[model samples]
Target: MENKIKILLLEDDDNDALLIENILTTSDLNVEIIRAKNKESYLELLDKLDFNIVISDYTVPHFEGIKALVELKKRNKNIPFIFCSGTINEEKAIQCLQLGAMDYVLKDKIEKLIPAVKRAIKLVTETLEKEKLEKELIQFKRAVENVHEVIFYTNPDGIILYANKAFEDIYGWKIEEVINKTTPRILKSGLYDKNFYSEFWNNIKSKDHFVIEMINRTKKGDLIEIKNMISSIYDANNKLIGFISIQSNISERKKKERELQRAKEAAEEMNKIKSYFLSNINHELRTPLISILGFSEELMNEITEPELKEYAKYIHEAGQRLNQTLNNILSLVELEKKRIEIKYESINLTELLKDLINQYSKEAEKKGLKFITKFESHKISIHSDYEITKKVLSIILDNSIKFTNEGGILLSVRTEKINSFTHPVINIVDTGIGIQSEKIEHIFEPFRQVSEGLTRTYEGLGIGLTIAKQLLDLIGVEIKIQSQLNKGTMITLIFPTVAKEEEIKSEVEKRKITIVEEPYEKKSTNPEILLVEDNPGNRMLFKKYLSEYFIVDEAIDGLEAIAKAELKSYDLILMDIHLGSGIDGVEAFKRIKSFPKYKNTPVIAITAYGMTDDREKFIDAGFTDYLKKPIMRTELIETIYKYTYKNN
Candidate 1:
């Protein structure tokens, strides 16, 4: 582009070389010409020096213009090579052009030399600029390939225009496969909904950049989470070109976050269970102790001869109630720990209900409530862990009796056929102060009462519903409740029932109450025994009355008695089923029967767990007799003689 262009003149003919040189020299255009006589010298000059254009003759001594042009190409592929022929032929000129010569000039018509050289120089300058740009393009491609993230360019219509090796690697696809495919159709993992992508585009159109977490798919169809950043690219005229996206895989990070959330939820559930246990345990232990202390003081004072006996009876009843609470609490803990073992058996629902109502009718009468029992038919039976179900039902019905003040408690069992199987539905409805709306949801929650007001007025620990809920849940029975504040609460328990041959045999056996021969012709020299246990205070009260007739051992826990089995031998073991391990007494008897030495031993399971299932579980776990805790002194003595020393 500068003045005085340096042109290399490679012509073997002296006349042509001189004429071309003079043509350029004489014109107003200034140019310096360097002459090479032959192809050898022209190529040598080209190697050592740069030239603006080359003017060469078509015919040389050893090499023609075509050979020299070929040699010029070897030296600089893009340099202008013009052939000046003495007798230029159309065929040769066409051949020159085909060989990539810039132009063919006739030496006789030297006028065209200057103009052709000027045009050649202009074309050569443009060619040089294009080569420079190509070099830069190769460098940029390498930079993109070297990056760790996937970097790609997609056209406005979403066809992938270009992508680096990393992009191909990240998607597990070859470059050719992804080059022209639309982004969404090829790589979407369905994690992004319509709104997600809609907002993505909206932001990009407004702000020219987008960043988001996306789940993308690979060529192999594997899903991966990625963090992507996209920016709009443009041309020099500010027209839309395409977009460049930079993405990094974040699949592992997303997985870790999900795992952490699950662990947090599990910890919260365990904490709730622990909190309930602590509250219920304290209440169960304290209630019976207060009753025993209050009644024992009255009896000790001997205020009235008739009242003294009544005070003693109250102490015994309180002790028995305390013991039942302890057992329930312990059993629940064992169930939570996954330590309770279940024995599945077939049971008759009708007989079980009758026995439960018979035992609880007196207590309901004492509370000024009528006990109503309606067993529709005896045919319905359930396959379950008899002991557990009995305990669960007992807790439910006991709650009804304890809460209802004046109205009658109704227990009804009906059978419904659904899906060709009989479903036994048991309902225990009470006219007690119904659970408040908000508190009803949590009534089955341990130690939770309807109100602080209700807790103060209620004499028992708030574990009956909790125990019922847990036991029913274990046996796949669903317990539902309906209640209105101050109106009433009705609990419905649903259990699957099927007719079985074994249950018929058990029913027939229960119907025949036969007398067995006595072990001794006369009562043993030792007197019959009854054991009463309530809270610690009630335990002392029962001990004073019962110790007069038989040897008595003490236990604060059902667990302690089970442990003490090896140290002492007794004709019978009396267990308070509701000892505040609340269900613990049931578990203790279960454990004792599990051992071969104690499996056949006579055990009298007594408690507030006097529900139908409570007695069934006690018997199923190898108890010879069952009694409700809070023993009546005269009744306790009479029942003892019936079981322990039957001979008259």
Candidate 2:
């Protein structure tokens, strides 16, 4: 059976409608007709039914084929429209055809109606398919134009064939201007040589894909960096057809990379300068500090009067505070360099916290603020570095006491679970002046402060929290801060529990040092010693501290020390690292060790270059031990006694 074709007849006469139906039926095709005698009936039938074709009698009494055609055109209907009229003239027929009638047929010659109907139906099917394809093409164009990257197609010879709208936006070129007239080389910035393009083309031709960064110039004479990916289009037979390239702009990323490299270099230079300045400043300050501390302690030891001894004790304490500040600066530098070593030990958190509280309680009381402590138990133990943990706890407590003026501070310790393991949590809560919300994030950055200017209230180098955070990080601890403006602040420290017994044993073993003693002693009344120092004040201070225990000889520089050591047999040498004009302490010690007599004698490094690497450097240069400046009298005396007496 033939497929049925639906037809709508807009004819006023019954005779013409019947004649058209008979003609279609006799043409060996299945046809169905729906008749509309007026404009109203025609529109109603058009809306109610789907028709493959419309055949209307032109120039009817009240309605005409042209009016029907106009209605169809207004509704955007694409059905085939034909004119079939009995009394229409040539001019009228031409007008009907021009008004979008697919074909014209006369009623007197109704035999021609079948052929015209068949032709119009065939044309309608092709027209529908073509319209669908055009719509799809428009959609594809829109998709390509809306993409962000530049896309273009070129022939095998590299001449441009098609360019998307994004290419116009990126390269500042009109699509019409570039087609068949430009090649990829037209956008080159000459940043790469011919060899680069040669290898790139060769690789893509063989591998069918090439991706790289390209520097190109726009039509407006601006340079841009782009990440370009080019793929070779191929046919089923593996023959190269053309090329498609997609380019994303990377100029901003490249610019940032260059800026970062420059910034890194500048930071490195600044660090070097800072290291030199700190070394010099510490040396200069510690020379006088040692004198102040040593003389005060000596005065306190010899004085009988209580008030005078009290005055001397205060002087010694003040000097110690200055020395602690210098040590903090040096420790921070070492921490930043990742050179600080952590010596782990099993520590009782209760005892450590209690001792720290007692130490700072007096300072808090002096400021009229009470210090409270809440320890969970008396036997809370954790594996950690004792000295570093102590320093970190002190930093947090100091900050709490320093900021809180009106309300008291509370210190608490307990055991808590963090992740998969149990950890010791220490919290310090202060009812003092709190940190601002915006400044909390920046508090752990070096030298950052909430208030600035000459009249600001707080006093600190702003390195306390930074040091605390870094030291805690070394021992696998976490710190968190919570604060509100004009209210209070709380800092929490979580220390990870050490699980292995081997670590604790190894730490203890590594810290053990054995001193050998001679069996028979040829003891001298006073052992001979050499004091090598560039600064006169430091030299005098060292001599005075050691004068009662040893026969001291002084050298102004490394060369003078070497000259004195060669002539005399000295028992010990205190060599300063930074000599003014000649060799430093390391070099002088190496020269002194060349002689067999002084090689066995102890030469200790006494300078302010006390970084992590400085000790190793001094030991490698033949020094027996290393000591930092602003030395305490007791420490100096003990070290001297150990070496001088043990050897004899």
Candidate 3:
């Protein structure tokens, strides 16, 4: 604006151009006048220069002012143009003005020329500013109309003043039906009380904005959930003019949330029912099965006649098979529900494998298969959940024995650098019926058997490997299987190496079970034991089992056990959990252990309640140890001896 206004002057007569420049100079307007002498010069100068205004003679030598004005407009649409003629031809002046000239003036009346030029320049500046403002307004309007959420503006009186296309599309209302035709009452579903409306407006006026999930009615009479946001709109003077509302249709999302909540409740109810069922199954069926299995095992061991012994063996074997199948089913359920808690501690993998070999070798012997170990010298100590680790390895070894009929199943161990860490690796290679290559990947999936339908010969639930794999994952132990159909399968286990022997873990291992293979020598003086059991058969069977080592006493219920303990504290107490419903074994243990003589005495929890959490639950209840029933004589004797030796 500080620069001079440059004018392109087109006039053949130098006198007229000089006069115009003098007039501008006299008016004290800052001006730079560039003259084009003729029509050719005028057109050429127009192409070469830029100017704020153009002043041209109506009667040039070869170009009329009309033609010059039209040509100037072709190049610059908004530049101001004025006509100056030597003769006072009124008709020609009018014609020049009609041909896009801002103003036309005669030389005799030249006073009007200067004022016309100034007014024309001022008008052009105002028009350009107005056009720029209008373009911005159009863009803002387009953006508001195209948004997905419903947006509307209202006057301070709450009457709807404006609404976007989204309002009609989302709320099921036409534009004409809503705008200035109704209040907010049209969208209200009457679900909210009058207090809700009062708070809605009060909060909006008090705070910067208000947001809520509101229930509203659509034009089609369908109720919907809306996430409504409202804020105040203000004028330039800071007066509240209207309110702006943004509503998101969240009906579908709300519906899904309700459905998910109901599903969660239903699942929880089913779990409660399942837990009850499993609890009953563990107590009712297992309680009698324990005594049956024990007596059958005793008969098989003591019977002299071959035929009678064979019959006893058959009963014992069938019970063992049923027990194992039940265990597998329960384990599968716990694993699927993700309810098994892993308690990691130091575990002797060497002893673990030895136990598995001892347990399964007889089964392997029945089929004339060699079950052997190659790493007895290598005492592999590892950090893992001892119970789960044992279960995982036992499952795999049991499957190996179950599948293999003739050849050997070998257990071997070695050291290797796996992932740059030296880990002790145990490999169980079995020369049994191997898996098909394509089926190996799916063996870890539950109930996915390699042999399907009636033609398959193997007797199993097909969840052994699935449970094995899941337990391994829980303990962070890695297992891999390699097999060829009908050749052999080799399973590799990489263990978490045990920390140094002196480095104790954060929590001491309560079940520090040392598998001692050597037989225990009997002491001359026997320690007495109190066997509290309600079932007559279980009482008889347990007394018979414990009589060889301990001077055993009996109680048929929890009250009797407590009464007996008040008289004399036994060296050890085998407390049965469910004792004919007369204040169960756990409560009796608490009372018996309160006596001075029995304060630190070993009170073993003997129960058929062997659910996934049962052992841990009982152990945490201050039992010296826990034994799931149908307990064999050897294990029961061994558990008693271990506690007595520790007490002694």
Q: Per-residue lDDT of 256-366 in model 3, one digit per residue for the tens?
A: 767866786797689778756865685677777798799999998899999999999999988888788778878866865667886767666777777777888887888
Worst 10 residues of 3 by lDDT: 504-513
Cα RMSDs, all models: 29.7, 24.7, 22.8
Query: What is each predicted model's overall lDDT from 0 to 1?
Result: 0.72, 0.79, 0.78
What 10-residue stretch in candidate 1 is worst by lDDT?
511-520
Q: Residues 1-648, candidate 1: write the lDDT tens digits.
A: 565678888777677677778878889776889999976787789899988788888778887888888888887778888877779889889988998898977877879877898798789778878888998999988898998889989987668988889977789889888889888678888777888777777666654665566799998899998878888888999887888888988888768756765675686587567847755775778676776767676675665677767767677677667767767767666655545566768888886766678878888988888998888886667767888887887888788887788898999999775433357889999999898888888998877776665337777667778877777756657688999988899998878445344542343233222212323232444543324244777678666656645667665554455545533345567776544321246665675566576665667877643333556666676678777645555455556656655432
Q: Output the better candidate (1/3) by lDDT.
A: 3
Candidate 2 steric clashes? 1
Predicted candidate 1: what Cα RMSD to the true structure? 29.7
- Off-target runs (Cα >4 Å) in candidate 1 are 1-304, 453-455, 497-648
TM-score of every prediction relative to native: 0.39, 0.58, 0.58
Q: What lDDT score goes with residue 440 in model 3?
A: 93
State the lDDT at 195 in candidate 1. Answer: 89
- Encode model 2's per-residue lDDT on 1-648: one tens digit a residue: 145778888888788777788888878767888888898899998888888888888766677678889987776567888888887888987887787778888788988888887887787778877988999999988998899999999988888999999999999999998899656678989788889888877766765656667789999989999988888998899888999998999999778767866786798689878876877787899889999989998999999999999999999988988888787788776775557766778999998777788889988999999898898888888777998999999988988888888888999999875332356889999997888998999999988766656877887677888889888766657789999877889999877654334533332233222111323243465678889897888988888878855888788766677666666678889888766433446666877788888768998888753446767867886788888765766578778777987743
Candidate 3 residue spans exceeding 4 A from truth = 1-59, 62-77, 82-148, 154-160, 180-185, 194-213, 228-246, 260-275, 332-341, 346-354, 357-383, 406-431, 434-446, 469-484, 487-648
